[model samples]
Target: MSSKLRSIRAGHRSVISRLLKKFEDIRDDGDEPVNTEELTKIVNNLLKKQETLQKLNEDILENLDEGEVEAEIVDSDEYAYTLDGKITQIQKLILVNTSTLSTNAKDFRQL
Candidate 1:
């Protein structure tokens, strides 16, 4: 994982945290007081952001797949191992976030 990629991921995490906070705030305040239109807009924005992040992660995984082959051919064991670890982490992040976002979508529909 390069420093730049790590930074990008950190930014994504921050955005997700803020979105979750908004959801929590709505729930705590009692959903009745929240404007339905506004809530719909917010959820739509969050879904868009999640989709963008998912695509970015997918791109990273593809790049890593290419690099992994190169690293193996070059006999760079450490670099190959690092790439493997990164691939695993990114896949896990995608899976976890996808499930979370799906849950959020369901909750929004219920409102």
Candidate 2:
């Protein structure tokens, strides 16, 4: 049981570390025309990992006592909400940057 718990925790940490690295990469590339295909792939991968982590967390909580599980659930929900918000912000930034690039391209062509 302890080994299973440790594995779950390690998996959770790995997912979170990967997500953070992706987020940093996006931010660092800010306003530069990013490859939309690559961005989409990264986002999809991150979401899949996040969903898996959430499911694993739920499984772990099911084995714990009510009070302890409740506390963990609250924290997990808050973290998930924050991650969702960050992802939304990143998506919006990409959209805005792409639009600006498109408009600039049109202006260059007209000149």
Candidate 3:
């Protein structure tokens, strides 16, 4: 990773740690006793998700480093799509298919 990006990520981690510390301090020493276990659980879950995303990003970077990304764009003169049209099209797609289907599958679709 680039040094600049690494520094920014470190800064974010520092800020999050500080905020979590402050939250625990408030929960530990407040006028009235408070339950912060749920909040702690949420914070931990968020941290886990962050780590997982970071790992995914690293994996993606490694894959990209292996080769260049190929992309293409094309412009076409097509009719503008509307929500209702798309909904109807999707309904038809789900309700039936153009090809063959099994009897059990057809029965399930009826149900």
Candidate 4:
């Protein structure tokens, strides 16, 4: 039972870490034109991981045995909400960037 809890904690950490890294990468890229395809892929992957984490949280809560661990999981779940907001912002940036690029291309052709 302890091992199962440990594994769940580890998995949550891994997903959150990966999600943070991706967020940093997108921000670091700044206003430079990014490949819409790549951005979409990253967003999709993050969404899947987020869904998995959410499901894991539900399972952990349902099978909760230890009182201390429940507090930790709740904290993690709150952080996950923060992550979702950041991810949504990134998606918006991607859409705006793609639109700008397309507009510029059309303008250039009309030059």
Off by over 4 Å in 1: 65-111
Model 4, span 1-111: residue lDDT tens: 645855876776687677667766766885765666766776787788777767766666777677767696778678788878867977986788776456536355543
Candidate 3 local lDDT, 37-76, one digit each (tens): 5444535544563564365445434544333322100100
Per-model RMSD to reference: 12.0, 5.0, 19.2, 5.3
TM-scores vs. true structure, each candidate: 0.49, 0.68, 0.34, 0.67
Q: What would the C-alpha RMSD of candidate 1 be, to one decimal place?
A: 12.0
lDDT of 2 by residue, 1-111 (tens): 635964876776677667667766866875765666665666676677678768877777877777787777887788788767766766776576567456536355544
Query: What is the model-wide C-alpha lDDT for candidate 3?
Result: 0.43
**Cα lDDT, all candidates:** 0.53, 0.69, 0.43, 0.71
In model 2, pairs of residues that clash are none
Model 4 shows how many backbone clashes? 0
Alpha carbon deviation, residue 30, candidate 2 (Å): 4.9
Stretches > 4 Å off in candidate 2: 2-6, 30-32, 100-111
With a 3 Å backbone cut-off (N, CA, C), the pairs that clash in candidate 4 are none
- Per-residue lDDT tens digits for candidate 1, residues 1-111, read 534554685587577557556655654574355444544555666666566665555455555656565643343345334444533444444455445456536355543
Pick by lDDT: 1 or 3, better one: 1
**How far does residue 58 in candidate 2 sit from its true spot (Å)?**
1.8
Total backbone collisions, model 2: 0
Query: Could you arrange the candidates by lDDT from highest to lowest?
Result: 4, 2, 1, 3
**Candidate 2: deviation at residue 75, Å?**
2.0
* Residue 12, model 4: Cα distance from true site in angstroms: 5.0
